[model samples]
Target: MARKSGSSGEKTRAMVEEAATRLIARHGFAAVSMRQIAREVGVQAGALYLYTPDKQSLLKDIMRGHLQHLLESWAAQAPDPDLPAAARLERFVRFHIDYHILRAEKVFISYMELRNLDCDNFAEIERLRRSYEHILEEILISGAAEGVFHHTDTRLTTLAMIAMMTGVSTWYRDDGRLPPDAITTRYVDMAFRLAGGEPLAEAAE
Candidate 1:
């Protein structure tokens, strides 16, 4: 059957994506089916095809959409290139923490669904993932050059910092003892410590 036209089709497509993300996150991508996703979205199974051609496409789109939005969001908050590395590094830590903690489901699926991706899809996602990681790597490199940061290895430090920040999604809760702000602050401090950076206040002087 053909998809509904106009605003209705657009709304269903968005709903399908949201439902798929939620379902895939709860039950690994391999365990989910288009029928299940369609049920969750309150649409017929065939209607899903109108939005995404197949299960793999849905998975790929979800992961790609999440990463693209992440990169764009960071781009908006990205610090001036002229800013000191310490400042830029701090900005990254805070942005990463704030971003991932709020979208736990998307973050979970993004990491957990890679194994389910076909080679070509996996490579594209990996490339985008690396691009995000490279942001931190470059910051670390710049800091080392400015003598504002010190690390044994830029690549290793970048991965460690990202893993640490993204780990918040695993256990953080709205009712948890620490608010997001407090958590972000703590991570920012930890990031500076990891980079051998002076506190932001001290670095500004």
Candidate 2:
């Protein structure tokens, strides 16, 4: 059968994506089924096909959508390209921590479920992932050129910085010892130090 018509179909499609994101994050992709996702969305199994042809496609959509939206969101709020590398680096660190901290589920699945993605899907996702990584790598490179950051390996440092920041999602809680702003500030200071830039004198506070 064909998909539902109009706004209702779009709404269901959003519901499908949301339910799949939640369930896949909780159970892992291979363990999730269309029927389970549909149940989570309060829909019948067949209704799922109306939104996504199959599980693989749905998984692809979920991962791809997440990355695409990430790129777009960053683009929307990305600091001016002409900003000093240190300023850019600080902004990037703060943006990354804030973004991933709030979407821990998506962050978890994006990394954990890579093995389940087919070659083509995996490649595309990797490309997107690399693109996101490059944003920081470029800042590292520029800062190095400007003598603001001293790093022999921008790629290695970029990956390490991202891992450090994204790790906040794994352990941070809203009611934890510090609020999000405090976490962002601390991570920003750490990122500067990691990149071989000096931290603000007051940042240690």
Candidate 3:
């Protein structure tokens, strides 16, 4: 089993990582430092080490947490004996956009600070990310076989869709424009269009 940190240790780690994620997203990882995160977390510089052994370690943990949360969300959203893959595809795509929008900070941080992750850490994150992509790709392929959707390259489309959803986290500000659900719905519409699926209301017409 993974060794868990004490409550205080977990809380401090959360604060520091939250600060790091915000600063790293706003200012590139190259521009942020452990000292800066420590200051933002209201802790002495050296104290940051109590949670993370080092800067590289801290970055790895943050990324791991992001991926872990993602895996959990997928597990929740994907039903057992699920509906048709096309329907599931819509849920997956829409849910992803909603998740990233709701947790924009984590999404932004994952996008920007990925360069900071060491080779092994980066590989693991990519592995989990690809698992998500594969799910979408499989659904699209199934839809293609059923003649309900068309795609020349399932991999390319899946990556493109993920990129589109991630981009939402970059620009979506809760106070700036639409609510998260509306934003997600619009994105789902756009994704359907890109995947060659007509919007439901339009299909009915």
> Which candidate has the highest lDDT of all?
2
Candidate 1 clash pair list = none
Clash pairs, model 2 backbone: none
Clashes of 2: 0
Model 2: per-residue Cα lDDT at residue 72: 85
Superposition error at 31 for model 1 (Å)? 1.8
lDDT score at residue 67, model 1, on the 0-100 scale? 91
Model 2 — TM-score against the truth? 0.94
Better of 1 and 2 by TM-score: 2
Q: What is the lDDT of residue 103 in candidate 2?
A: 91
Candidate 3 residue runs with Cα over 4 Å from true position: 1-6, 175-177, 202-205
Comparing 1 with 2 on lDDT, the higher-scoring candidate is 2
Backbone clash total, candidate 1:
0
Provide the lDDT at 174 for model 2.
84
**Better candidate by TM-score, 1 or 3:** 1
lDDT value, residue 21 of candidate 2: 93
lDDT of 1 by residue, 1-205 (tens): 1224379877788788889998988888889999999999988898788989999998898889889889988998899989988888888888898888889999999988898999999999999999999999999999999998989988888888999989999999999998888888888888888888776663332
Off by over 4 Å in 1: 1-7, 202-205
